[model samples]
Target: MSVTTRVYVARLAGTAVFDPIGDQVGRVRDVVVLVRAKGAPRAVGLVVEVPGRRRVFLPLTRVTSIDQGQVISTGLVNMRRFEQRAMETLVLGELLDRTVRFVDGSGEAVVEDVSMARQRTGDWLVDQLFVRRRPQRVTTLSLRRRGATLTVPVEAVTGLAATTRTQGAARLLEAYEDLRPADLADVLHELGESRRLEVATALDNERLADVLEELPTDDQVEILSGLDRDRAADVLEAMQPDDAADLLHELSDEQTAQLLELMEPEEARDVRRLLEYEDYTAGGLMTTEPVILGPETTIATALAQIRRQDLPPALASMVFVCRPPLETPTGRFLGVAHFQRLLREPPHASVGSILDSDTEPLTPDATLGRVTRLLAAYNLLALPVLDAEKRLLGAVSVDDVLDHILPEDWRESHDERLDEEASRG
Candidate 1:
């Protein structure tokens, strides 16, 4: 097969890799490139995920052809895992979706893709970028419209260097948009600390908060510490009160106080309340935000509230029926209504009529063991936590119970297992 003169690196993602005799080797995951100080970066190798999910480097020199949907390589291929060097950059992971300014004063644009060309010397060098202009506001009409996309020489734009501090993760996030928060956290955990911080910095507070909840405590603290104080506080406010409190417990008193002071008073108050409880108690595990409804609320209203896209599945599993004041610390906790039961009843029926008042609620000081047993015995997704006056305070989801009962180093152990499996292969 004749080698193509130029190819867009992003298009190579998931392209099959085969040996000279046509045996499949792996699939392309990313392109490794050595960034230069004053010019285009030189292509280093392909990061290929082979059998056993092990990522190994395939040097461009070993590649015989780069055709549509496939790459042909020399039979000799190293099986060792790929480890990125300090001077290396991942084209798909780090470069794409970055905002850059054009050298000719044509306004800012976002990097959509990059193209590398084989030179006369047989070296592959990144020489062009496919970019879309940033959306501009039309002051006259008070409207905004997306700009056109154009292919420009790499030298025509700036901020492509690996050292660029202002790099954004727009393109990178698009590539991983389908990933769940937990899976995205795993990807973030595998990145170098600096790159991970960069990506975190680029994410909006809400998105970062969701990802932080899924990360290990140390990682959560590290990423939070890297953000600006105000931004960090905003992220905390975006997280569930229980999760925010758990992360704050891992930080120093001074640091936690400073962040709390930066947060909105209403949001900080909920977290402060959770922080007052012991780590393994129901209070510490319960989220201050749950579907709390008044007795008079129609089943239609309750269903509409839980059907919100923002509500987590566990929290949405049931509705806590209470008296006046539907917020936490709600008046006279009435009972609970399972989601399935709501679906079976008429939409106009009141939640108060179909309550499961028999099931007992957990007090804040209830032991973790008791909470776990109740969740199992009732087969409940969430259990309400109440105060001495029987006022609804929060609800402990089954996920919170599992997080506490699991080994402290479970996340680390999961990573180790992946490495062990790769080593065996």
Candidate 2:
């Protein structure tokens, strides 16, 4: 008959990663230990936090064995890195300066620092680590006590156990459930392109919509490329109209039509109409999915609607007061109100009474130059989009405009310029 053994966290659930064979490599921020009734206990996965470096996993193949209640690996299968830390092991010290990332999107945030502290279990364990930026010296480590903390609860972690036992690339989708859209976006941005797609494949349409708004346009395309036409259509349909239009602009006409066929008739038409506009122009960037109500509506009614949508208080600062009229010139499009003015007045007040006459609207022909200038004028995130007849077609965000026109090419250009200066000197 076969026998089994028990395995638990070495000190705390979080420990600094290190090279088992090297004098110093890095620190372990996360570790997964595996055990089965039929086999030996072993360390399955690892994330080492080194000061100011990208966090990379040690593929499971590099592991030699598991003993002494710890993971044993010869060295990183790729190249070797070393970092310095106080009160760590050869295994621990090896990982000192290597980078590590927790649950953020895309690739590893370069590791800035690792921290250890006493847990309620009466043992020392990893507390929090972080990726940091320096005031000078480009990107560097931030290992101070204040960095490296995450708000996510332990209950929220999905596949941490299996991830630890197994090595190679981790699919975070399998490990986490229902992350906030912003949080999910941050994770996707940090993951590599391939892994980003892997996680995107796991999200539901609404969640996809939420995170889709937060990603840059290129990343939205990357995530869309991973889905089939039907799934892709569902994702687009669920998104805020402006965000969906941005992604559609990136797809080829053939791919666009194919995905459109899978969308609901209403959404497909809305997206199609937006696609007809020049992508870089304001008309192309405006969102058609904004909340609108009649000018006659009461604050109490608007407040009820806000509660139903579960919008945060900050967003309530100005709910758009829409006309909702169906007459010629689409009278519904001409109405407007600010949330701040509403809250300051009595609950029974009419939207028109509190409407900020100062609000300035934008037309489709506007350029990015004009858009930025107008945003500065209104100090607004949600701005109105109107047709020639002054009929409101949609709303545009300051973020959408910037994400569209500003190419990531700048980062590469800067890198090249640095190399050139180095060569010239």
Per-residue lDDT of candidate 2, residues 1-425 (tens digit): 11112222223223333466544444444443332233222343455533433233554345444344344556753322212122212212122222333343322332233333333433333333333322222234533323333333222222222322112222234223434566457556655555467567767788877888777667888889888878888998888666787787778988888988989988888788788788667788876655567778888777666565534343344556555553212454545566665667889987766766567777887887788788777677667777877777766777676666676543113223323323100
Residue pairs that clash (backbone atoms under 3 angstroms), model 1: 97-171
In model 2, the worst 10-residue window by lDDT is 1-10
How well does each candidate superpose onto the true structure, as a TM-score?
0.75, 0.57
Clashes of each: 1, 42
lDDT of 1: 0.86
Per-candidate local distance difference test: 0.86, 0.54
C-alpha positional error of residue 52 in candidate 1 after TM-score superposition, expressed in Å: 13
lDDT tens digits, residue span 233-326, model 1: 9999999899999999999999999999999999999999999999899998999999999889999999999999889899999899999888
